[model samples]
Target: MNTPQSMMLGWGSLVVAAGVSFYYAKKTINERRAVQESMGQRPSEKLDCASFLLFLHCL
Candidate 1:
């Protein structure tokens, strides 16, 4: 029952949201890495491993 224009609008909004999420995630990861490097630590490790474990347990 949907028109082509409606479908295009939905897809366009999805693409824009995905693009914004990618940009913010990339920026945040870069900043975290910079902070870790400055502290002489590995940038690849989780910053809250215990919290993650607790969250998983709750889930």
Candidate 2:
């Protein structure tokens, strides 16, 4: 493929991957929030920086 075509293909692939990643991340967050609600926890509770980091690490 020519340089411009290859570059377009590369950028398109990156955009698609990013879109899929964002979709899944949002879905996972929603699922987790539901689980928290089911467990009697408030999903709307705010976490401090360290706690937020720990939560992400646990994931």
Candidate 3:
């Protein structure tokens, strides 16, 4: 069973992971927006729910 210290560590890791993911997502969105603006085109949406589900099943 996990002790209090272990639980705290796990929560800390989760917080760190969430922060990193948020930062990366924001950076990617900004870069993609800049590229789209320069190219005079909207960023393409290549996949929808059905394709995403298919991809999960493939894995």
If scored against the real structure, what TM-score would every candidate get?
0.69, 0.64, 0.64
Q: What's the count of clashing pairs in each model shown?
A: 0, 0, 0
lDDT of each: 0.91, 0.92, 0.93
Question: Per-residue lDDT for 1-59 in model 1, tens only?
Answer: 88999999999999999999999999999999899888989656665988888989999
Q: Tens-digit lDDT track for model 3 on 1-59?
A: 99999999999999999999999999999999889978979745668899999999999
What is the C-alpha local distance difference test score of candidate 1?
0.91
Better of 1 and 3 by TM-score: 1
Per-residue lDDT tens digits for candidate 2, residues 1-59, read 46998999999999999999999999999999989889988656778999989989999
User: Tell me, what's the RMSD of every candidate?
Assistant: 5.5, 5.2, 6.2
Those runs of model 3 whose alpha carbons end farther than 4 Å from true positions after fitting are 43-59
| TM-score of structure candidate 1 | 0.69
Candidates arranged by lDDT, highest first: 3, 2, 1
Sort order, TM-score high to low: 1, 3, 2
